[model samples]
Target: MDVLGQLVAVPTVNPPGESYGEMVEVLHSIMEDAGYEVSAVEVPRDYLERYIPQHADHPRYVVIARVGSGRPVIHFNSHYDVVPPGEGWSRDPFRLSVEGDLVYGRGVVDMKGGMAAAILAAQAAAMAGAGDFGTVELSFTPDEETGGETGVKYMVEAGLVSPDYVVVPEASGSGNVWIGNKGNLWAEVEVRGRQAHGSTPWLGLNAFDGMARLAVALSEELNSMLSSRRSSYPFADPREAAPTVTLGGAVSGGAKVNVVPGRYSFTVDRRLIPEEGLEEAERELREALERASAPLRSAGYSVELRVTSRSPPSVIDPRGRLASALSDAVREVTGSPPRLTVCPGGLDTRYFQLAGVEALTYGPGDDSYAHAADERNSVSEMMTVARVYALLISSLLSCPGGPPRSTSS
Candidate 1:
């Protein structure tokens, strides 16, 4: 709880990804005190983007704590960045506001609390000589809320961590381990038109209108497939829960009401189920977009698409060693086995999976409260996860440098 409070106090909002350096130090110092050799790596230059203006000046730091050099290195990762604390709030978004058992604050449920739990748990495991049992790597990353190209993605691509197993303390319900997540394709599409006085309507093309046509046409063509592609993952909105596309995250173009829009741009959030092939899905979308934009092209306009990010759907083998160890640890700590879940959204676990390393997420936060106004986490839940993490670490760090025994000591 103490660690969680300190974490929530730092406002690491992701829109522009600010104050990452501060967050990195807090996590670094705490783990260093617990006997881990920590490293702070700046977010790579190539990863920075002008779209996130803050990065042009504000530095992003990925803090990594290495406790041992043993084999079967197990990684516990969590992003420190939180979404904006929108709208009404009873207390300061950066400070922890408590009631009964709930700890209210921005980033509490979505993940900072989870990050704290991992840190404390790692501290306990280190005290138990768990590091020598096997390697334990705890990474605190930023830029997750905004696609992690500059955070986890950077670390993974740079060979910062090559763990045999990874446990990301993302918001995965009470203590359920998230074995996989539906993939995502985050893209921005633009429609171009010639600017002219709005009074002379026929003199110029309206990019906004052209974009509207494209959206409608794509929807008409893809909505059916989205609805019919039955997903194996369990979601509350099953009827409409298949692979899907959400268009127009935000729209921009016209500068004046009297001027024809010269250009229009919008974002797309496309979710992919495990069964859906990413290439096939992207190809289909491109085909649909090309077909829809044909009319606009003939009319002397243009369409351009920028794929900001793409993550393939992750479906880990649930019976793997890491999953088994976590399950055992959770059962020991909570008196029942934890359930395996498939998330509807993306997570840093996807990057580890991309490298063929088995990874899962099980943490303290309540998913329902994530990114919502007055986001909060239960102190009791955080404590429970900390205990479970300690147990899992000790078990996985057992005898062999590579695999745990049939049961932990």
Candidate 2:
């Protein structure tokens, strides 16, 4: 609780990446005091300029701590960055408030609480002489809330740490283990037309009308295409196992009611199942848009499509050693077999999964409160996660005559 309080008080919010250095320093101290070799890996300014230019001045850092050495390495990761506390809080979001077992703060539920648990788990395992069997690594990273381009992605690409198995404490919630996460392809469609008086509707090509036609065509075509496509993976919600599209998350159009809309654009939030690939999803979307806008093009309206961002879906074998070990630990600590599932949204696990290293997510707190106002987590839940982590580490490192550690890359 003390460690969690200290972490929560730092307020490592990410857009402008405030207090990242302070957060890294606190983590360095905690890891060092727990008797681990610690290092702070800063994101290079030039790299940031190429990837994320707006926040280049703020800087980014990932704190890595290691104990023991050699094969069967187990890596634990969690991000310190929290989303901006948007609205409605009973007290200060930066101050940790403990009332009985529930602790309240901004990052407590979303992730810092889980990071604290991971720290304690690693510390307890090391103190119990559990490091004799293998190596354990812990990393506290930045930029998860805004995508981990400079965090886990950078770590993996820079060869800062590599492990046979990875645990990202992302709070699958209610004692469930997340084996994967959905990917996304964000896009924007713009329909351009000439403006004229609303009274003479025939004189101008109405962008709104063209946009409406394209949106409806897209919904129909995409829905039909995705209808037969469902993920083979298990999700806590059955609907999440299938691909989905949310249209018009943001929309913009005309200035005056009397003017025919000259321009219109809407954002597309297309979610992919683990079975779907980014390239195929994008191609299908573009083809559909082109087919739908053919008539609009002939009618003097111009259509444009922009792919804002895209990420690949990630999954791990549920029956693999990493999943079995985590499931065993959950059952041993909580007396319930965790439901192996995939998250509805993306996570840093994708980075490791993309790197061909096995990774999974399990931690404390209900995921619903991740970005909610008065976000909080139960102390008992955090401790439970810590116990599970400790047991998992012990099992992976010290289990005798278990699965042989793989020597291949």
Candidate 3:
């Protein structure tokens, strides 16, 4: 609880990421005090300048802690960054509030609680002399709330970690384990027209009208296309099994109520299922935009589209040795087997999986409350997840085990 309090107090929000140095220091101190060798690896300024130039002044860091040595290393990872706290909070978002078993704060459920749990679990396993069999590694990374360009992805690309198995303690539900997550494709579209007085609207073109047309076209074409395709992977909701598109997440247009807007722009969020291929998805979106814009162009409006980011879907066999070991630990600690499912959201596990390392996610808290106004986590659930992690570390690293077979979707 004390550890969780310290973590929650530092609001490491990730758009232009705040207090990253302080957060890394806190994690480093915790891991160092736990009798593990720790390293605070900072992302290079050049990389930052090239990729995220707006955040060049804000440094990024990943705290890595390692105990013991040898083959079949088990790595536990959690991102320390949290989303910005929006409106409607009853209490201070940065202050940790405890009521009975509930712990409330901005990042409590979205995953600083999971970070604390992983730390405690690693400490407990180390104290039990579980290091005799193999190595246990813990990484507290940054930029997951955005993309992990400088966090897990950077580490994997720079050869900072080479683990046989990885466990990402994301905010999966108490009785659930996430073996995979959906991919994301973010894009922005812009339209240009002439500005003129609203009283004589025919004197100038309306950019907003073009934007509306494109939105309608997307709703008619993209939505219908997505409806016909569904994933074979199991999800609690059938709707989650299909790809989804959300438009106008951020939109702006018009100079004033009395003026015709000269320019308009909006964002797009497309989530791809595990079975979907990235190239095909991109091609479909591009084709849709091209078809929709032809009419707008003929009507004297200029349209432009930009794909800001792309993350391909990643998955692993749910019945593999890593999943079995973690599930056994969950059952041992919670007295019931956890259901293995594909997360409908994006996760950092994709980075590890892309590196050819088997990975899965299991932790406390309901993911539905992740970015909610009153995000909270259960104290008892946190402890239960900690015990589960410690037991899994002991199970896999306390004895010799062969390398698990590689499997992917």
RMSD of 1: 3.3
| Candidate 2 local lDDT, 196-273, one digit each (tens) | 999998899899999999899888888988888888889898888889998899999997999999999999999999
Clashing pairs in 3: none
Off by over 4 Å in 1: 49-54, 233-241, 297-300, 399-409
User: Which of candidates 1 and 3 reaches a greater lDDT?
Assistant: 3
Residue-by-residue lDDT tens digits, candidate 1, 86-130:
898878989888898889999888798888888888888788887
- lDDT against true structure, model 3: 0.88
Ranking by lDDT: 2, 3, 1
Q: Which runs in model 2 stand beyond 4 Å of their true positions?
A: 196-203, 253-260, 401-409
Question: Which run of 10 residues does model 2 get worst, by summed lDDT?
Answer: 400-409
Kindly provide the TM-score of model 2 when superposed on the true structure, using C-alpha atoms: 0.94
Q: List the residue pairs that clash in candidate 1.
A: none
The models' CA-based lDDT, in order, is 0.83, 0.89, 0.88
TM-score, cand. 1: 0.90
TM-score ranking from best candidate downward = 3, 2, 1
* TM-score of candidate 3 versus the correct structure, residues matched by position: 0.95
In terms of lDDT, the poorest run of 10 residues in model 3 is 400-409
lDDT value, residue 9 of candidate 3: 90
Tell me each candidate's RMSD, in Å, in order.
Answer: 3.3, 2.4, 3.1
**Candidate 3 — which residues are off by over 4 angstroms?**
404-409
TM-score of each: 0.90, 0.94, 0.95
Query: Which pairs clash in model 2?
Result: none
> For residues 1-409, could you state the per-residue lDDT of candidate 3 as single tens digits?
8899999899898888899999988888888899999998889999888778998899999888998877568899999999999999999998999999999999898789898899999999889876666788999888988788878888899989889889998889778998888998989989998899999999999999989988888767788889888899877677789999999999988899999998999998999999898889889988888887889889889988889899998889988889899999999998999988888888899999888888999889988888889899999999999999998888886544556423210
